[model samples]
Target: MTKRSEVHWRVSEFESGQPFIVMEQYAGDELDLFKKFIGFDLPDGTSLDEAKQIRDLLSRKLIRVSET
Candidate 1:
């Protein structure tokens, strides 16, 4: 099996009513599964930070659909 190296974010929004942040309309066959987040477990840690960093670094060289 092969893993997808790209992902497209269809929608990125913040919901105050929810406990966890949700990335809706994300489209990726396999890469999504391999993606690692730094703050997934930390309540104070911002997951968006990791996402943003990756976006900044890869957007110019690769395809990374990111939203902060």
Candidate 2:
């Protein structure tokens, strides 16, 4: 599929662990509408500075932020 979609990340927690969520949503597409977010794990030794950097990187790669 040669389709492109905007994406964003939201910080979320599941149970007692913090997870980063990557969400992708189609803007205007027929018969191919899809929305999903997959959580990422911050493994041991991941520092706050690193997480912040990742967050910033995601922000730069995003088209816009949307609440779900």
Candidate 3:
């Protein structure tokens, strides 16, 4: 039998009202063997460019947090 691993994440909004995502936990025997994926869907009034900007900003912030 083969075993699979899982990763958990949380999404929340900043004080400024921007949304961000963070890794909450992982439950698996092999963290290296697991693949991670993330997705974002633009809201009804949001444009593609605005969505991209938000995604980029969130990514950068997360990266900074991870580095610290």
Candidate 4:
């Protein structure tokens, strides 16, 4: 028996020039997996301060997810 568990994270950009973070989870087999989006869309000319805040939030979410 194989006990498999994994989590994948990625960033994707759309043609409209917005970026979003995607998270995927896998257990046992590729067929048994789930995906979710963080819903933080960054557009062109985003402010540095705002970017920093988003980064912090993303880090927190990543940490929480990794703990599961």
Model 4: colliding residue pairs: none
lDDT of 1 by residue, 1-68 (tens): 55444543221224532123222224555454445642222244446665455445544454634432
User: Which should have the higher lDDT, number 3 or number 4?
Assistant: 4
lDDT of each: 0.40, 0.54, 0.46, 0.52
Candidate 2, position 28, lDDT: 31
C-alpha-based local distance difference test score of model 4: 0.52
Q: List TM-scores for all candidates, in order.
A: 0.26, 0.51, 0.35, 0.38
lDDT of 2 by residue, 1-68 (tens): 44555555555545555444444553533224344345567775565566667767776877644443
- Model 1 CA RMSD to the hidden true structure, in angstroms: 8.5
In angstroms, the error of model 2 at 4 is 0.3
- Preferred candidate (TM-score higher): 3 or 4: 4
Which candidate wins on TM-score?
2
Q: Weakest 10 consecutive residues, lDDT, candidate 1?
A: 16-25
Q: Cα miss at 45, model 2 (Å)?
A: 6.2
lDDT of 4 by residue, 1-68 (tens): 44344544456656665555555553334422343344456768665565566656655565423332
> Candidate 2: misplaced stretches above 4 Å?
26-36, 45-53, 62-68
Candidate 2 global lDDT:
0.54
1 or 2, greater by TM-score: 2
| Candidate 4 Cα errors over 4 Å, as ranges | 1-5, 26-68
